[model samples]
Target: MSIEEPMRKTEQEIMPARASQITKPLGYDIYPYYSLGDNKIFNGYSSLCDFIIEQKTVVIDGYVGVYWNKLITALKEDLIDRGYALNLIESKNYLKSQAQLNEMIAPFLGTEGSVWGTKTTLTLADYFNMPALTEIEKSTSADINIITGCGASLSDWKAALIYVDLPKNEIQHRMSAGSICNLGLDLQKEQTEMYKCFYFVDWVVLNNHKKALINDIDIFVDAQWEDSINWAYGKDIRKGLEKMSSSVFRARPWFAPGAWGGQWMKEHMPQLDRNEVNYAWSFELIAPENGIVFESSSFLLEVSFDALMFAQNKNVLGVHAAKFGDEFPIRFDFLDTFDGGNLSIQCHPSLKYIQREFGENITQDETYYILDCKDDAKVYLGFQDNINPTEFRDTLEKSNLYNEEIDIEKYVQVHQAKKHDLFLIPNGTVHSAGAENLVLEISATPYIFTFKMYDWVRLDLNGKPRPINIDHAFKNLDFNRKGATVKQELIIKPSILFEDNDFICYHLPTHKEHFYDVHRLEFEAEVEVETNNVCHVLMLVEGAAITVESADGAIMTFPFAETFVIPAAAGSYKMINKGSERAKVIKAFLK
Candidate 1:
């Protein structure tokens, strides 16, 4: 369903009012990096070219959206200027043609109107011409032979392997700018289509390839910036990752604006750009889209989150590693609707449905921990006691087709939201975060399986109608969760699990469908926490700042609204309050 563009004022004209009192200055470090040893990371094209020239044959493989043309051009000029003959083999030439790739991936792309796609079973080698790659791998007749592209490693060449990585957020930015294409494709598609291809196909194949070559990679490069490059030895990166897996760390969080954007993040996070429409999402620890940054002597390098998983999945996930393998099972993010519109009424796929349809191992079982909310804030969840499935579907479809507004509360139950309220949203439970609240969405790692039933009859940021998925929602909705059942099953009642004079822990239990549980530690001074062989995903919910000190005495300070992780291998850690008031931290771990 679609609608005509609605006339609306610019974001600047509709800015929300500022807070009356001054809050703590934003302490979120956008470029949080783990420290690599000095001299481990090298910068500049000159140094990179110098290192490549010394090797007889070098293959430079990287993620999609990396600027291979510029990288190769710079290396070619520098090597030729240094009086070395170069045999530059472009890896794209050996890949499958555009028409062939499109035909191969069509089954997974689904319909044009659909946002969901089946995870691809194809590998990087499936997109390549093996004969051509073998021929190139056999011939090395120049002073320095450089093979570079997305699947350069598939050549099976016995040479120095360098992997260039681009962050997921940067790849989206480049997609929006029309500067990059999907794997094995020559032409750029529209942003949404390109993102769909990237998510369902390109990323899946590339991540598999990268994991296979993680240990064999001799060097790793961060190609996020245009003018400069950051490179480091692969061994050093592995060492840093190993150290981090046994300690506490934070992924570099990224922010974005959306149709239902809010002013809460803009007002509290001073580092964010106030000129934007509004900040609606802060990707705190969504592992698939997040990157771990490593710093060395003032230089910074970022490798995708998968690198950490591939290198040390056992240490990071502990006993759960056996089941999840390289996948991180938990996610924490901020859904800001403060002084903004309500979120689209949506529900996620059930576990069996997600597995059969999307090939995902987990469903998006989520919980909204209300970190802050205005007095009138509310959360739409479940259905009324007298809800009719057919009638609800008819009303939603009519709303979508005719651009009419439906009385949502007539069907769905709306509960008042307050600070520290935890609402459990298992798969198939219809829910939406109402306006004037900051929701810390802690959930399973499958983040993109939402099926929106209604969108409040509003135009998106691009002035286009947002996708409505009534059919998909109906297929997965749990009508049993209605009225009294909703309150008994979804609304979390906090109970004191542990206590003392100065410290206490409150257990906010999740639903039966959820594999994880939640605990809020409120401490006036400090509290010692044991991991118990399960990784802990935590956020500083109610304190200005707190210091997380590992057993080995490595300390990292996280401020309010910051999401950090304590690996299962960490064993024990201490959270020392650095603020004037009691520190409250939300902790999520395996059940």
Candidate 2:
């Protein structure tokens, strides 16, 4: 079968079903582990046999985290059956030696120790010998030249390029399970390089496949080694996205360890492998590190969250789509410090500063909604009335350089955090969550712009001093949010906005700078929620469980600590409490 011929046939086989057939709530068993059945084209080895017979060369550029030998062997065996000779090219053969990589990254390393700056930029060409690969492609005599590496750049030799996409969670899972080797690279540097690979996958590979070579690619598979595999042609795969956008969306949550990690998530999220040291964060809705799940009859498909934003930006963001375009404008993540230490004393940049410095559309304006906290837990916010700016700067510098434990209380104010306290942290306000707190950080989507000023003079989990950005902090910090002003404005007091027979809505006031609003929905039976052309982000903050039903009759349940999104296109939905006790949900949406 020719590639162009199979394209039309596959489209007919996977055409979008009617709205009713596709909008049903997926069974609990249909995600993260399930596999869609094999076909001749999608997620199947037979899909590429024709390519091996037709093309003189093929390249399989994939992440180093994958089992490349197994995948390549499968392709080679299939090619042999089709009476074609195959020559294998290993990317590792061209990698710079350990000493060379270390020297190349030396300038980016911090002077204090082995820590690396966030701006350490490395490209795929920097790590792999692409010139050598091009030469091999030109000279190879085999019927098919299978070039396998992290295909971070587009090349003509990559005729019929197929990206074997894997979620970041699964990549870490393979790493932690000892299924893949780390190649003796610094963990931070490895992560940095992997992120660059991801950028290439999304930008260079996916964009070209979905746009330029929409009908030319062989297969794009969502792979989890042997457990699951899903494949689709570029065009049919895009049609699948349209069906998914209007439905209830959930991203695969990824857990990672941190210096100030806690056991809260390890105890709560049983789906995670708890053998690890600690789980500090659940990247619940951070699109960069998250993935959206799509289910078919036999298998579940997973793509990066940004794929949905790219395909259906207006459907997901609704009226706010113009402002954010393909970027999802809100973030929801857990900051677990329970039985751990405080977060770094930090503040996010203002909009102007973030745009000029970090090239971000919006700043990380944030709010800390206390989900769970120990009795003695408190939040350090703003500055004390008598804090001297010069003294504070000098103290932080000394702490960073000389490891001095300057009295934090002398400069920063601490406020008691309760079960439902909402602390508004607009950009430029210094803040940190104290020990023994489970903080649900609801804020604008721009997360990585945090400028840390202090870190309690302790080393990071990697046994190195974390980078401190005192100059950035001082430039963005708003000292006027101090003394009584912090208490009056930053510490939000919730007020009842509506009440009925079975439900009560309490408005949690946001800062003037906040483009979104947070509301606590306390209910015994049910509550009618309108999308109002703005998407709503929901968290089961104080509940055993609840079910969200769309107007079209599609429904999905949410348990405690679970994060779910309702696209503005879904219009209206109902939140029905299923537990015996009353349920409380923290809902954030555009104001």
Candidate 3:
């Protein structure tokens, strides 16, 4: 496929250089990776050279590959490359091994283990001392400098710096290592080893820094501003680059969740400070160095993710992208069957269907993390003791167990789900987490691609029967495996606990592919906050927090806590306790 045209910010909106300022250019690099057949291909241009020639005014039009090189060459020969200079980047021979390929490419990436700030430098430091020499930048006063393209998914794209773009009426998701698509994502997930950039944590994003720093855009970035609820006093705050933020305040406090938004604000509100207008964003938290703050009692800084996204972007950018997140989100999903969705009768389609049509891959694996239930949640997993795919389909069709127009019983055996249970359901498994209970769903795509067997004839949210993909699913459902799930328990250390007046927290990395570190916290403050990750999403089952911060340091504290969210690029910030007792919260890394 041709490179998607680069989305460009209007030039007229860009700040003009001072008449007396030097017009020199700077340079950097951007690498693009694609695959051909089972083989992998790598290419990039003199990112440094291009930056120099593009000078101060440039559009990140497209990637420079074999074809792009020709365009650059033509531009250079035509003399239109005047302001935009580009040096060619050499290509290395393609290696035969995947491990070796990663090795060769790793060096060009952001420093590994570098502590990319996930919150306002000022605030994060106040609560947790530098775990390592960390990088913090102020969203306001910090000079803009670099720009580069970051690979989607994995880790870097999540916690550190994620790009924000509105969703089009249609989206073309890359599939099978950029090799093929149309294989409906449900089936393709197995063929492609797609992984998501863990969404809840800040570390993954920090590791995936690939873009150049830009100074022209003065928008403040902070994790705390995602909600109107405040953070604990001195919650993790961030500053840009090296400068300590001189101001802290909320950019958007009116965007908290709960239906009582207006009534809540009317009671615990403070007059808006015009001096902080230019420096405020709905989500960027700012609190001045002197300690003065601005906020409200009804903000929802920490609430359901979709609620926060709608509130923040709509108020600030005046645009609405779904709950997909500020820029990109690690949308891993999981499917479990039992009585919840008809299980025994349904199945998934095979690899061929996924690759040719569904456009799905790696991120689709289903894992079950059970919370509670009756004698544990009984699930329909795998094929019944001895049934093969052929027999299973026959039983389903014969028993009238497979019908979209009428309810049918999926005769697959049901298993139990205890706390912390782990069930890896591969495709073709007519299994589902069938018990009614609280369970954490994990996977790559946020979709329900089930070939339902029976739903007890339950109507969908729209009061319509949910259609079943019998033909496609039966082909993919795995018949080789069956029975109950397994669990691997780890000890919870005392060190992971964090409790205070504003919140509680716990973290553990270095456990698995650095996939994630669990975090749990609670808060009730009107503090400004910022981070370097896709930001944090706090599920508020209990208390609340109001976030308050500004690019120039205006503290925008909400009176109450609702679920809240944080973005990766957020700069300086803080969270102030506004209620009685400590509010509880949990933070998960989306690495």
Candidate 4:
């Protein structure tokens, strides 16, 4: 009789050190093997796919290895009997370190991306409003501080990094293999007058204000292929940014003619008036046919953030592009709208909700930063102070939220936004910049794959039904928060402000993998900082700052303070604001 005793469930055990999973590439002579039950061995064949198939059922517990030899031998014997001589193949030690596993897989991320530009001089205090950035150490929802590559310039680089299959680009592959592969970069070295000799990379990394310089094509900036690859790695992505200083660079407002407004916004959101907009610019390396756009419940405005739309391509992930950590592509915009479309609202789905419904393909989380605003520029941030989902939905369907009479801020928290105002909105947090307003939105990579919940009785110009995923909305809406603060409100201390300027250094407050938790250094003063990790980004907001050297011959300066990055290997650097106004900068570091 079967045992009638209580069930005995066992947990998996930890593994002891092993020689497998070494630098040896797939199909290498040194194959992986596992021991199973007696006479039930299996083979970890050379081919990665083959090894996976052969070891499919093998238990990998260090204490309970599944035999792999016998199984492979049996399969081989059968193949031989059938007159087939198996061929053995293996890859070289192409992998430099365990970190390469992620690098080898970057081709799986997407090609298109979106990001915002500066109005005047963006300050460190304003970065909190930036869209989300992916962090391998921690998600935006999670308390982590690490960041990877920013998408503000992702469009400018993605086409070269993705879509075109390199192997098929026979000539390009040869050039890359000879010129890029095996060709290591000397971080301490210099090449041409304007370029670094070995730093062949993909993107010219920068912060919001510095990147805005791209709007003026007349400026001749040094770029190379190695830096393009630099942009591919999380740690190295910040390499070239060390020299940026925001103090003296002239920042053209987004509203300036030829800055990508007027004719642009006129066609998309006819309601948008050129005068109301403070500034606009295209940060995309190359513009897409449709330009950058974002959606809300009732309002669908051609967003201010720039995006380089990729032609249809394969799935690629930049999980390891940032060698130091993983970061998400987030964008932002200061909407200077004249009317509050009764339907425009802020809402997002949760990770759990997206996974359960749309799987991994749909990832989203967003936040907003209120910039300059008029007294009447109210917004709908989060749900009503006290809300009953059922009751709210019942009224929402009736368009009560859409009635122009409904002052959205009264339902949530209404606050006027002056320069340097900051707000943090996590995913599932129901918030919106409401009608008749201007606000800076900082958020995670803008992937509209989320399941929408509500669209305030709004329609496209064609007057057709706009899609809504209410069930998904309810799944992620964060009902606990309202207004400017995130989940647990952080008390603001004036000490957080940079001296003599509105530059703010509110802690990003992240806790996860050790790489992204290092606190941020926000400032515009003549300050010096030592590097601890391999990467860091110093996004410049306002003014010009130069990196200068000390009498000890150990100083480095970023004279022009636009958004810039400093690599860990850069040693020590100092910043000096050349502008009459205070400089704004963020010192993001790896923990």
lDDT per model vs. reference: 0.87, 0.69, 0.30, 0.31
Per residue, candidate 4 scores C-alpha lDDT tens digits across 204-280 of 12223223422222111111111110001111112111111111111111222111122322333222233433223
lDDT by residue for model 2 (1-591), tens? 111111110001121211123333222111332122243234456655564466666655544455665666677777888787667676667767767866765544334332223333555456555576456554456766666655422344746666666666666555444455443242333443444333323233333333343335455566654533456555555665564566565676666677887878777664445666676776878875677655545445566676677778788888899888878888999899988889989998898987765445678999999999999999999999998999999999888888888788899999999998999999999999998999999999877667888888888765867778898899999999999999999999899999998788999999999999999999998898888888889888887888988875677787777788888888888899988899999999987
RMSD of each: 5.5, 8.1, 19.1, 23.7
> Mind sharing the TM-score for model 4?
0.41
Question: What's each prediction's TM-score?
Answer: 0.95, 0.79, 0.35, 0.41
Error of 3 at 459 (Å): 5.3
- Highest lDDT scorer: 1
| Clash totals, every prediction | 0, 4, 177, 100
Error of 2 at 477 (Å): 1.2
Off by over 4 Å in 3: 1-327, 332-356, 360-362, 365-388, 399-443, 446-448, 457-465, 474-485, 488-518, 522-534, 544-563, 571-584
Error of 1 at 510 (Å): 0.4
Query: Pick by TM-score: which candidate is best?
Result: 1
Candidate 1: where is the Cα deviation over 4 Å?
1-26, 137-141
Q: Which ten residues in a row have the lowest lDDT in candidate 3?
A: 27-36
TM accuracy, model 3: 0.35
Candidate with more favorable, higher TM-score: 2 or 4 = 2
lDDT of 2: 0.69
Which residue pairs in candidate 2 have backbone atoms (N, alpha carbon, C) closer than 3 angstroms, thus clashing?
35-299, 36-298, 36-299, 43-231
Candidate 4, position 17, lDDT = 19
lDDT of 2 at 266: 70
Ten residues in a row with the worst lDDT in model 1? 13-22
> Per-residue CA lDDT of candidate 1, range 18-123, in tens?
1111233548655566787787887778888877877768999999988888788788888899998888898899888888999999888878858878899999
By lDDT, the better pick of 2 and 4 is: 2
